[model samples]
Target: MSERVLVPRNRGFLFLDSHPAGCRQLVADMWQACPAPAGVLEGDGPVALVIGSSAGYGLAATLAGLKRAGIRGIAMSFEKAPTVRRTATAGWYRTAATAEIADTAGRDLVFLNGDAFSDSMKEQVADLIEQRFDGRLDYLIYSVAAPRRTDPATGAAYASVLKPIGQASCTKTLVFDDEGVAEVREVETGPAEGDDVEQTVAVMGGADWERWIDHLAGRGLLADGFATAALSYIGSSLTEAIYRQGTIGAAKAHLEATARNLNERLGKMVGGRAVTSVNGAAVTQSSTAIPGIALYTGLLRGVLGDGLVPPIRQLAALWDQLTGAAPLVLDDEGRIRLDTWELTEDVQSAVAERWETATTATIADLADLDWFHNEVQRLYGFSVPGVDYSAAVATDIPWPDHAP
Candidate 1:
């Protein structure tokens, strides 16, 4: 037998793998470490399933929905690697943490590890629902994000490319290597052809969401009055050329369209409804991968640190709407409204103006780049409070439900 290689884990952080007992301890610690947000619910619900439910706003949404709706049981699907070799995705650690918390609370939880876009995965999920749940699901959340997806209709695999709307554009980005500020410029890296746009839309957009809903409904697995939701975002114009106005934006537009169709389909099913929550900007792994968003998010983080509304608070608010604690306001486009706050006239105006006037000496004052960097790091389980950074650690935490 060959010798096993040890991969380095993020020591002194919550990303470390904990065995079953350690996982349990970590859950209890986090519960005590963070206070429940104001107005959180403490009850039990019908049942909920959070797809792509491991990290970023999705994870937060899952927790908030459960806490507020009193959801008793949850079935989640997360695409993550094993922690044994330390090569696991960050979501692997996060799912472990979530499972530990749910178990400690006596909430019945079943976690599925696989690609949510796969048809066989849906069958497996349906079977799990029938066996573990009482053949019905009350709440469903679609939150998967992939750089590439195989189109069900065409059987073609397309990779999403992020680029500016027009000619080359350069912008300043925060550099953590340099103590305070540095100028990082980006140009359009790829051409977004018409077919590329359509293919990207088909793969990453709303078709998968529709398929999931149809599958559940056709199988009679959705309960009466059930609700399904998908989370979307529209960033500021500073980054919109690469995001909202570009290929990804086209995909999001399609996603919003799917929401309308799902609403009608669900309405005809059992008085059920479908909702799409246009969420606020946050420093997520996916967000970081998008060019220019890092700079935008860093600036927003600085602004937020100065007492502006944070993404977590915004997510909590979205959860409130999901649980009927708050009403969802819609824009003229017939979509749930939230992006306006982040891409507000005032906020966008400031970022755009700063982008024009910013230089190496002036970029720091243009926005809170430092704050954004810290928040971005925090999102990855780094720079958090109460965690020591010098501890020896191992990444081989065993999955409680993993069968050899």
Candidate 2:
């Protein structure tokens, strides 16, 4: 066996190994806690396809569709396969675990692992839809978050950057160390140079999402009255400099524009709808890498506590709206605003006050770093209650069903 034990090393807050059992337990918990109401999903045969379905909002959207909406889901993800020398990525474990449980419950969901930003992958999913989904896709949830994406046509890989657009930004942020200790530090980032914004948009923008819809519709796989949602974020003024107004912001803007175009296209073609769901800030794998989100979410957790809505619940609300159980809640820009709780006047006022006074000492009181840190660990299958970390585990977990 390899040195698969979870140990403390000098890698800052970065964790490279994952626990398979822990991941399974977390998935099981979500499956049990998730609310599933019959007759809410509306249709006789509801189907969904989730790109980047292994973790975070992607995973939440997948589960929300399955449990909340009663949809048959096909999860498309690219996760590294586990080998004897090292553990697979947490997403790999999560996907495999999810498949095992779905199988046991006789629920309909399958995993396809591969690069999603490629034409071949798109065609492959189309074929899967033909075989498994009766050739009609009712929902497409595009929640991909990657550092780089290789253009399927040109083979040019564009990496997304988190820097601001016009000027540099210096803000206070929180970072966790190897000992799981949290500290506040002043981090400076921004002012995209060169073709940074263009590259970011190229990688993170709506072009790929549009291409997917185009391909699916062209292949006659989109169901009548189909719907698609691309997950996005429009943070508060606290982190807007490095987020909403940053290079990533340009990418998100392009994503929203593409949604409008796709909405028009879908309406004309199939009576379908496309929306960019402006989701709230939460402790996600991608959000942790952003400049100011850590501090923002920390204060958010402290101020809101139980008032804060989890991404999964928000996604369930998305299902409710899409299924006609509720009306669509939109902002003036025509995007769904699930972030009203995050940007509330009272909550933001408290967070703003905390941000002003937050420091190495006061951060513990003003911000909930412990909560943030624990949530992050839960993503990687660590810090989960009742998991025996000392016991040896198998790394060669299979897909438990169909493979891509």
Question: Best-fitting candidate, measured by lDDT?
Answer: 2
Q: Model 1 — which ten-residue stretch has the worst lDDT? A: 1-10
**Model 1 steric clash pairs:** 43-70, 44-70, 45-70, 298-372
TM-score of each: 0.84, 0.95
Summarize candidate 2's per-residue lDDT along 1-404 as a digit string, tens digits.
Answer: 34455642325445678788888888777776667765544454488899988898888887777777777758889888887666888899899877876666556777888888999999988988898788999999999988898888888989989998888999888888766778889999859999999999999999899989989998999999999999999888999889889999999999999999999989999999999999998888888888778888999999999888888788888888887868977777779888888888998999999999999888889887778887888888887888888877777777656743
Model 2 CA deviation exceeding 4 Å by range: 1-5, 8-10, 38-44
What is the C-alpha local distance difference test score of each model? 0.65, 0.84
Candidate 2 TM-score, C-alpha based: 0.95
lDDT of 1 by residue, 1-404 (tens): 11223222332222342222232333334345333546545544567778877766677665555545556545455544653344345566567777766666666766677778778878888877777778888888778888777755567787776655555445555444434335656444555756878777876799888888888778889998888888888877677767888888889989988888888888888888787778777777678777777777666654455545544455567656665677866676556666666666777766666666756577677667656655555554544555543543344443437221
lDDT of candidate 2 at residue 13, scale 0 to 100: 46
The positional error of residue 59 in candidate 1, measured at the CA in angstroms, is: 1.2
- Please identify model 1 stretches exceeding 4 Å from their true place: 1-44, 73-77, 82-85, 152-154, 165-172, 175-182, 306-308, 400-404
